[model samples]
Target: MADFIGPRLYACYNCRNRVALHDDIVSKHFVAGHRRRAFLFSHVMNLVVGPKMDRRFITGLYTVADVECSDCGEVLGWRYEKVHEESQKYKESKTVLEKFKIVKDNW
Candidate 1:
């Protein structure tokens, strides 16, 4: 999968400090322990955003990605909502991307 939350903004997904994307040595430290836990938490949050049975408000907080503190095995941040006014008209669309486009372009 594409790293939408690119390493440019994410540091090892474990370290809060800044680091390069391809720095395998640094990332490996994070990946080896906390990667799975972080991803799983983020995955669940993503699912909540795309609920099949309910229509919900668009909150301003969103789970951009998961992060772990390299110094400690702590899962930080997940599935947050961002506040924005959106119409429910697109709720029936096939994909959330389609809804996002419509909402963004005000179509």
Candidate 2:
């Protein structure tokens, strides 16, 4: 994970819409797409602008906010947000691994 440290560029694999996550975020980041309970709580995930969210399924295990590419409107991934669950407070965004790529030491 040391290789992940430094200036990183997070881009949507669909249209290559990119966002920068600096060293600080890199040092304390989480794998957004992991299925484990611990993986869903990471807060260092990058947020890209211009991408829109669709909550077609809002009443389920988790309130899903489907995210898309800002330019081409491709399916990037979904953000699992905690809704109506007072015991568990969780909100995390995940970009599809096949639909997104991270380039470390970008600068």
lDDT of 2 by residue, 24-78 (tens): 2312323344431112223324443332444432233555555454556664445
Residue-by-residue lDDT tens digits, candidate 1, 9-103:
23323334332222221211111122332211111111122222322323322223222333443444322233233542221221111111111
lDDT of 2: 0.41
Best by the lDDT measure = 2
Q: Cα RMSD (Å) per model? A: 16.2, 7.3
TM-score, structure 2 vs. true: 0.44
Q: Give all candidates' CA lDDT scores.
A: 0.25, 0.41
lDDT of 1: 0.25
For candidate 1, the 10 contiguous residues with the lowest summed lDDT are: 98-107
State the RMSD for candidate 2: 7.3
